[model samples]
Target: METDENIRLRQALEHAAAELPPLPDLAPLAVREGRRRRARARFAVATTAFGAVTAGALGIALLPGSDPAPATPAAVPSSPAPSASPGASYPPVVVEATPGVTPPDNPDGLSPAERERRAAHQQRVAALLDELLPEKVTGIRPVKDEVAVYRITAGGASFRMAVSVRPTDEPLAPCPDLPEERGVCETVAFDGDREAQLMAMPVNGPDTTGSYLRFSYGKSRVLLSVDPEAVSAPVTPRELLDVAADPRFLDLVEDTDARPVETKEPRPVAGG
Candidate 1:
């Protein structure tokens, strides 16, 4: 039924189709590629979600009122330790001595052994005075070259005080003979037959500011005096007498009496 031209055209098309290569089946490769892309997308989504969750947890941990992290412990030394030394021996501690006062020579003509004894006794007495005195008396420093004499600082003022035990047959010092000079004199009785004379005299015969006490302890005359000329509110007489009555104070007097550290005859010292 076809004409010659149609027949020829159909023949040519068939020839061309036969000469061309066969088409490949791309369905499996497309499916594999789609699966791979889906897998990569799921992985990216999971990673982003994990990062966001980690960031949120960190932000909550760093908020105010959160507990702080524990601090790191200090590092211990690696070097070997040295052994401790034995305890050291120390001399007896005494109050500071007064400055600029030269210690006088042995005026009592005491033997070398006696001088050493006296020096030791004086040191004991000085230390005792520092302890027994009132708290107001800040310090009690021994005057240079003097025996039993100390420079006391009280209420920001410097004053002189003497505590001496000398061999004497003299009676307790009496109050001032002058009517205007006589301040307050009283007899204070202590335990046993012990007694002391306490006198408070005026600075310039009218100012009324001095403290003096004298008593006989054994064969020695115990004298206690404080000069409060310009000092305001000097140590009271009751305080001075109370100190003299202390058993510890009397014990020192007893020690000195047994082996006298002072001169039998009173000699004027430079500071005293």
Candidate 2:
């Protein structure tokens, strides 16, 4: 029941299929797979680079000494200005003002009896500085406010030694809160939990400078400062520290509370 045209069509299709040479072995699929692998490697490298940059930025943000960000400013309202001189024009002038440097305010607060007691304590400290220094100290004493001034000859040069006292809970504060005094401070532990902060610096003077030592004894804090002058050699900071740590010097605080005078609280120093 088949026609000659149907038989011819079937025979033609079989011949075409046989001549196609086995479909050329699937067109080499590994090329597409290799391209995919390379893309993944590039993406991983880029991700690692981005992560490193982010970590570096975070580290900078967390650094201890980094400057704080500037504060945002609010919008300002505009106002009409007066006219300038008819024929004169002036350039913009910028002025930078330096903040004032001042010592800590009276810690005892403002009171008559408290002021008298503080004055008495200061007088005693000044007397002690005069009496207790090493035997080599001698000269016509000069007058200075809040400090004991003495002229001394040492190491072939004559210079003035200024001894001052600063009572505080801690030796120094952090960053801006610390005193503006020029010196390097070091803390050394002593008996009975007492600590002595020793500092030394050569300020603006002729090859002469001072050393400062602050310590806590009993309920009060004290500072003993000494300035020595010499062209080639100056007193070592250790000797000054030893003098400050001496038992005789520490005994000065014994009469603070025992005396009938009311005591003043020490100014607090910022601590880290």
Best of the candidates, TM-score? 1
CA lDDT, every prediction?
A: 0.58, 0.42
Q: Pick the candidate with the highest lDDT.
A: 1
Give per-residue CA lDDT, model 2, range 124-171, as digits (tens).
443343334443332112221222333333422434454434333454
lDDT of 1 at 23: 86
Backbone clash count for every predicted candidate, in the order shown: 3, 0
What lDDT does model 2 reach? 0.42
What residue pairs are clashing in model 1? 103-145, 104-145, 202-208
- The lowest-lDDT stretch of 10 consecutive residues in candidate 1 is 84-93
Weakest ten-residue segment in model 2 by summed lDDT: 87-96
lDDT of 1 by residue, 1-272 (tens): 89999999999999999999998889999996786456445434433343233222211111123211112112211211112112211112122233333223454566655544544555555555655566566544444335666556565455678889989766655554545665778887885788888878777536548888888977898888887746433677788887888777777788777767666855446697
The C-alpha local distance difference test score for the whole of candidate 1 amounts to 0.58
Misplaced by over 4 Å in model 1 are 1-112, 173-178, 265-272
Off by over 4 Å in 2: 1-132, 140-184, 205-207, 228-234, 257-272
